[model samples]
Target: MATRTASCSCGQLRIEVNGEPLGVGVCHCLSCQQRTGSVFAALAAFRTPYTVTGEAREYLRTGDQGGRFLFRFCPVCGTNLFHTEEDVGDRSVAVAVGGFADPSFPPPEASVYDCRRHGWVVLPADVTVYDKDPE
Candidate 1:
């Protein structure tokens, strides 16, 4: 199994994951854009039981799909680290792709919130797209 490591900008927070990610994808919802301060937010989901180090500040917000979204960031440098889904129970955890120390992490297989994506942002021709949520 491959172990991935990540850290905040100030190096105050660090995370190490054992094995590969559960999934990876980009979210184009308005909330995601606002939270990430970008056109879309990239995320890598993983199963529990991984080693996570350092203390991170968190913010919780509700999503358009009525799911509760949590954002965890470094309190010092304000580096976004990971997030958790309230609606999907507690078995899954999502880490920001940018936080990964690996340069060749898994690419996103699908995209969400296509309805809110920027017109100039063209998606891959073969990837699955969701207008709103995956459901």
Candidate 2:
């Protein structure tokens, strides 16, 4: 199993996953843009059994589709680290790709909310694009 560790900028919060992500994607939704302070938010979803070290602050936000997402960030540096669907069992977790700080990390497999993506940004032709969240 290939393990990957992701941490906050201040190194106060860290997550360790024992295997490759179940999926890797990028979100161009307005909320994701605001949350990441970037054009898009890149994330890698992994199954349960991961480990978290250090405390974090959480913010709950409702998506455009009415799904509630609980975002966790480093309390010390305010770096958004991971998030999960509220009320759902611990099946998976989505961690911010930037936290890995690894250039070799896998590329995003999908791009969601493409309608909100910046006109200047271009993704690889291999990436599957969705105007909105895929069903």
Candidate 3:
């Protein structure tokens, strides 16, 4: 199994994960844009056995549909690192793809929140796109 390591912008927070990811997706929701300060956010989800080291501050926010998610960020650089889905159980969490800083990590399997994506944004032809959350 290949182990992947990622860290925050300031290198204060580090994460290591081995094995395949449950899913990979890109989200263009308003919240993602605001949090990442970019056009969208991409993440890879894995189930347990992932290790996170260093001080990370967490922020919990209610979602668009009233669900809640927990976001973890580096206290020093304020870099978003990971988040947990409210209903994904305690063993599963998603890591920010950019934190890896690996150009060849993996592309998003699905493009979500297309409705909120910028008009000029373009995506690959093979990626599944969802206007909303792919119901």
| Candidate that scores best on lDDT | 2
State each model's CA lDDT, in order: 0.83, 0.95, 0.89
- Model 3 TM-score relative to the real fold: 0.94
Counting clashing residue pairs in each candidate, in order, gives 0, 0, 0
CA lDDT, candidate 3, residue 7: 97
TM-score for each of the candidates:
0.90, 0.97, 0.94
Instruction: Report the backbone clash tally of model 1.
Output: 0
Deviation from truth (RMSD, Å), model 1:
1.5
The residue ranges of model 2 lying beyond 4 angstroms of the native Cα positions read none
lDDT by residue (1-135, candidate 3, tens digit) is: 888888999998998888878888999999999999999999999878889999999999887767689999999999999988776578888999999899988788899999999999888888999889754
Error of 2 at 40 (Å): 0.3
How accurate locally is residue 82 in candidate 2, as Cα lDDT from 0 to 100? 96
When summed lDDT is taken over every stretch of 10 residues in candidate 3, the lowest stretch is 84-93
Q: What is the lDDT of residue 53 in candidate 2?
A: 97
lDDT of 2 by residue, 47-123 (tens): 99889999999999998888889999999999999999876769999999999999999999999999999999999
